[model samples]
Target: MKLYPIESGNFKLDGGAMFGVVPKTIWNRTNPADANNQIDMAARCLLIEDGKKLILIDTGMGNKQSDKFFGYYAMWGDHSIDKSLAKYGFNRDDITDVFLTHLHFDHVGGAIQWNKDRTGYETAFKNAHFWTNDNHWEWATQPNAREKASFLTENIMPMQESGQLKFIERPQGDFKENSELGFGILFADGHTEKQMLPHLKFMGKTFVYMADLLPTAGHIPLPYVMGYDTRPLLTIDEKAKFLNAAADNNYHLILGHDAHNEIITVQHTEKGVRLKDVLTWSDVLTGY
Candidate 1:
């Protein structure tokens, strides 16, 4: 199996919101903020190539939003999914599966695109089956007031409308090992209800896709949870548990929103789980 990092684009978000109640004095050290107090973020997606199935994890924010919407997010950079795919000699049509960690706009926006005539929306990966779990599907479709803004209908809806949406059947436990995808699935409710983090066995190592649960290496500490999470207290507990497991098993974490760093590993320290090493996708490839 081969894994590729696809950078969809870069955007800026309020550092305060990203780091939650964590003081700016602390998080700013790792993710320095701009003059506007915003920090750089990436809509980095992962592509998994195995056999004839080309699976893409998390489509970054697509370019379909209006200028006003883009203005709010401070979207920047020339990187795009098309160019990134071309870099690997592939295209959107080659993707057979789109595994969404969650339905937030930044994570799932690129899953759907505007049709040729601009009349309506269509699945971005025409040949792909958009994969998300039943619980998250409902949570996003009928979003609560707090998360309603992040779950844009334009970014979703079209996948199901196109008859290409496939919901992953939740097995009879809190976590289910998906043999078909060659990964184990862990459900995290702290960030959002039933956010599926994939524990992929690749290159003789275990790699966990740390969606919003652990947005960046700076969030390695238990208290550095995002303010956007509905349940901050629950996030603390969830993070601690995940970090302990990661440190004990030496799991490499694939970050979704970290603009500068692609992968990281943690170690148990006196203060708690702390960043052990920061690595690029190339480092993993070369090691393999």
Candidate 2:
């Protein structure tokens, strides 16, 4: 199996929202804010080449949204899924599965696109089966007030309408040892209901996709939760538990939202589990 980092694009979000109740004076040290108080964020997705099945995890916020809607987000950079795929000698058609971490726009937006006629929406990966758990599908389709804005109908319904949507086997409890997609699944609820975090062993090490549960290395601290989380107290407990296991087992966390910090490992520190090191893709590729 071969894994590649696919950068869909970059955008900015309010640092305060990203870090939650944590004051800017603290988070700003790591994730500095711009004049508008927004910080850089990456729609970085992962591509897995397992035999003939090309699986893509989390499609970034796509380009189909109107300029007025996108104005809220400071979208920047020339990086795109097309160029990123072509970089590895592949294309959208080659993807056989799109494993969504959640249905939020930034994570699942690129899964659907405007059809050629602009009459309606279509699945972005024409040949792929879009994957999500049953619980998450229900939660997203029938969203609550706090999450309604993040779960856009256009970004979601098309996959179901296209008849390409699929679900992973969800087991009772916070973590599932194995998923249909061939990765262990970690379910987090603070950010969104039944949000799945993917973990798979690769390149002689274990890698866990930290999708919002631990968005960035800066969030390694238990208290650095996001304002977007519906239950901040629950997030604190979840982070504490996950970070302990990550430190004990030496799991390498693949960050989903952090634009600059790609991958990381944590160690037991006096304060708590802290970042052991910030690593680049090349560093992980060489297994140093």
Candidate 3:
């Protein structure tokens, strides 16, 4: 199996919101903020070429939202799913499965796009079967007011409407070994209800897709939860348990939202589990 890091695009988000109650004085040292207080963010997706199936982890926020709508999140960079796919001599049509970690716009927006005439929305990966768990599918479709804006109908309903949506059997416990998608899944709820963090076995090692569970390395600290999360206290506990296991097993974290830091490996530190190393995509392909 071959794994590729697909660069969907980059944008900026409020550092304050990204790091929750963690004061800027602290987080700014790690993730510097701009004059307007926004920090660089990347919607990096992962592509898995395993035999006949070409599975894409997340699609990133696509370029379909209106300029006015996108104005909120200051976007940057020329990277797109098309360009990234082309870099690997592939295209959207080649994707057979789209495994969404969650239904947040940044994670699943690129799964659907405008039709040829721009009349309505349609599946971005025409040949792909979009995957989300039953619990998350229900949580996203019937979103609470707090997360409604992030779960846009245009970015979501089209997949189901197009008859391409599928649900994984929600695991009875926090971790499931070798899910239907052929990888272990670590379920996290502090960030959002039933956010599935894929535990992929790559390079003969464990690589966990750090979705909202650990947005960036800056959030490695237990208390630095996101303001958008509905359950901050729960997030702290969830993060502690996950981080401990990640450190114990030497799991490589593939970050989804960090613009600068790509891959991270944590180790036990005096303070707590801290960043052991930051690796670039090239570093990942070549060696440790």
Stretches of candidate 2 exceeding 4 Å from the true structure:
none
Worst 10 residues of 1 by lDDT: 173-182
TM-score of structure candidate 2: 0.98
**Structure candidate 1, residue pairs in collision:** none
lDDT of 1 by residue, 1-288 (tens): 888899999999999999988899999999999999999998888989988889899999898988998898898889999999999999999999999999999999899888999998988999988889999999999999999999999888988888999888897866898866777888889889899998888888999888999998788888888999988899898888889999999999999889999999999999888999889988998993
lDDT of each residue in 146-260, candidate 3, tens digit only: 9999999999999999999998877678988754578888888887899988888888889989989899989999988999888899999999999999999989999999999
TM-score of each: 0.97, 0.98, 0.98
- Choose 1 or 2, whichever is better by lDDT: 2
Lowest summed lDDT across 10 adjacent residues in model 3 is found at 176-185
Candidate 3 has which clashing residue pairs, if any? none
Model 3, backbone clash pairs (residues 3+ apart or across chains), number: 0
Give me the displacement of residue 238 in model 1, in angstroms: 1.2
What digit string (tens of lDDT, one per residue) describes model 2 on residues 110-132? 99999999999999999999989
